[model samples]
Target chain A: MAQNPNRPISPHLQIYRWGPHMAVSIFHRATGFVMATAGMLTLLWWLASIAGGPESYATFQSYVVSGGEEATGMQVAINWFFRLLALGVTYSFFQHMFSGIRHLLMDLGAGYELKTVRTWSIAVYIAALTATALVAMLVAARFMGA
Target chain B: MGNGTKLGRVRGLGSAKHGGKHWLDQRLTAVGNLLLTTWLVLSLLWLPNFDYETVAAWLAQPSVAVPMILMLANIFWHVRLGLQVLIEDYVHDEGNKFATLTLLNFYVIGGAAFGIFMVAKHAFTGAPA
Candidate 1:
């Protein structure tokens, strides 16, 4: 139905003046996509590895958990990278989840004020980082037998 | 100042397609993911180790397995919805978008079915002695 579908979308990233709200908007989709692809793949792989029993799970642990001592050069680096990516995926979960909460409130006809909007957009960063940190702490505590 | 009738001016003006069902599904799934992913994180945190035996035993619990299945299903559904919006907005070419969206449908369904089957497998079969 378009004689001309030349409607302009939003400005490109370089030209657009950025804000936390804008970042939140972008991160919401970015995080969702990350979780959908990499996070989901890893989760499925993790499950399947475990289901294959300790033999396969040991390989997962060595690569995913410990950058094993025997690993050299690129091997250790790749292992560590996947380990870092796991944390990144965790952060993505919180970032997307908190931003979703903010959007949910907006859906319910609340937090529409300009000031409130800005506050929450920034708060999502702080909250997500804090939650990820807490998860790290809990995991550390468990490993330490505390 | 150019309108024969109010309806005339507004004839084809909207998304011109399905209204807000996509929007509503996104929000509803968001709420479900919020609850279920939280449960997943907590359950994972409670486990002592990530070893096959320990984690597998944990998942083998009926209490854990049921929510795990639900959580996996809900998360996949939410992801699928989000990806649909994303692919629609960004991928403009009709053929390419159609192919991408079709791949997405299969990916999400296969992922969810596989995950659900895995959970059921774990539920029925405990880790080795």
Candidate 2:
């Protein structure tokens, strides 16, 4: 194998300017990573709540406990912010899950044809959007009393 | 059947390889996690407050506790799978890659299980009525 000084490198995602679907896919992976980070954070919350006794438990709830020493009005507002954050994270988690299952299926030798792959990708995208919107509406309704 | 195939002289090439098995395990766990996460979201929605007794009671019941255990196990397994793929792609040094992957797999599983066990023990035994 003769070594060429000017060997052609394969084009990666960055080689070409990003398009809509490519950007969406990148965000999809990013959100999945974010969800994983959130999972670890939740594990921390669980451990602290379970380990630090009732005082720690109270501290965990302090975020949502309005007009209290542990939670001031501003803190309550922050907690509500987290509630909205939770809703977004929830939607991302599910949408990622749904799309991941499709990828898993493709990895298993299914959906290899270009037509089939594109069709499923579109389906997954649509499902993700619909699911995210539906979940956000449901969660927002809880706060709005609708 | 090809003469130039590398398998002819490979003395230790046996049925010990389990790549497909690992792939299947990862896929199955991924599916389990998806199902459990749905339930988890609904449970979180139903949670009225974050009091100790409430969380403890919810966790102590077998209905919820069992799913929680399964979810923990599967999530760690999926994490291991994702990390393994990442390490395989990025880590070029063979010996170091093997060591790091092995350590990472063990750490993820061990830490996750330990965290779950600690929480379960607290929920089952420590909370007051």
For every model shown, what is its TM-score relative to the native structure? 0.88, 0.72
Q: RMSD of each candidate? A: 3.6, 5.3
Which runs in model 1 stand beyond 4 Å of their true positions?
A1-7, A144-146, B1-10, B13-17
Best by lDDT: 1
User: Residue B93: error of model 2 in Å?
Assistant: 5.0
Candidate 1 to truth, TM: 0.88
Query: In model 2, where do residues sit more than 4 Å from their true spots?
Result: A1-10, A16-29, A47-53, A63-88, A107-110, A143-146, B1-16, B48-52, B93-103
Error of 1 at A56 (Å): 1.5
In model 1, what lDDT does residue B81 have? 83
Flag clash pairs in model 1: none
The residue-by-residue lDDT of candidate 2 on A51-115, one tens digit each, is: 56777767665653333655566888977776666666766786678677786777879977867
Per-model TM-score (chain A alone): 0.86, 0.65
For model 1, what is the alpha-carbon lDDT of residue B39? 88
